[model samples]
Target: MEKNYFNLLQLPVVLPIDGSLLSLHYQQLQRQFHPDNYATAPDNEKAAILQQSASINAAYQTLKDPIKAAEYRLSLEGININEEQQTIHDSPFLMEQFMLREQLDDLEHAQNWDELTLFYDEMIERKNQIYAQLLEYINQSHWLMAKQQLYKLRYYAKLIEQIELLQEKQFNL
Candidate 1:
């Protein structure tokens, strides 16, 4: 059986998890599973410890990130969100995405600090709103709606990454 990340991390398997608490739990697990402590053990024991350590690390990584946590949660409910096969049929969202991308392209050329900051803020707001809806849908057991929100959230995340890269370039140059 696939390991339940929430259970492994001692989390409640809920959205909007406490990041600091998660980090605390992760640190405790790391200390418990650190390989150096088992160096004097037999080879088979060492191998098993290593596997347990790896599983702990994987669970931490997955549960630490909101998107990954949501994906894992959905998978647990048997709703596999296949990015390649799943199509977001919301036309308005698609149109908004195109417009946002167009704006981003123009911002790339213009390199206006104020505009870039505004766009970044806008993306953040959109991401927050989507996350709110995602939480609502998930709470209500609206799996499909939550899945669609997750897809939209991914796009906003990419936009945020691009904006941050642009900001980094500006800072360096």
Candidate 2:
């Protein structure tokens, strides 16, 4: 069985957690076990704090991201959402992504920021809708649908990352 990150972080097993709560919990754990706080302690104590701090950081990252949290929960439920032999057979979703990529590729040099911002806003709205459906699936204990949405969300996340990199490159020019 997989270890429960929610328990490790002292958080409830729920999607759409309050970001501030996660941050607060992480900060509290960090302050308690940060190596700097054990500077004057023995070497063994420092090593222990370092290990604990690393574990806390891993738990924090898992809890803070909705997708990672979903993945962890699904894994615990005995569902492997791993893409080993799995393929996204959703044709409509793939087509939509293709069209979005087309738009991104066709972006002109002029007015790039405004155009990219509008496209990013559209992507954000769709991503939020995906998240809502993912939460509903989770709340209802529908692991299959949640897994499907999680896959889609991961794809969107990668594309959005590319968009952000493009923006950074343009901004730096």
In terms of lDDT, the best-performing candidate is 1
Question: What digit string (tens of lDDT, one per residue) describes model 1 on residues 1-173?
Answer: 86688888888978878999899999999999899999999999999889989999998888888998888888888899875777788999989999998998899898887899999998999999998999889888899999999999999999899999999988887
- Compose the digit string of candidate 2's lDDT tens values, residues 78-171: 8898859766779999999999888887763454788998888888788888988988998999999989988888888877887888888787
The C-alpha stretches of model 2 lying farther than 4 A from their native spots are 1-3, 36-48, 108-112
**TM-score, candidate number 2:** 0.85
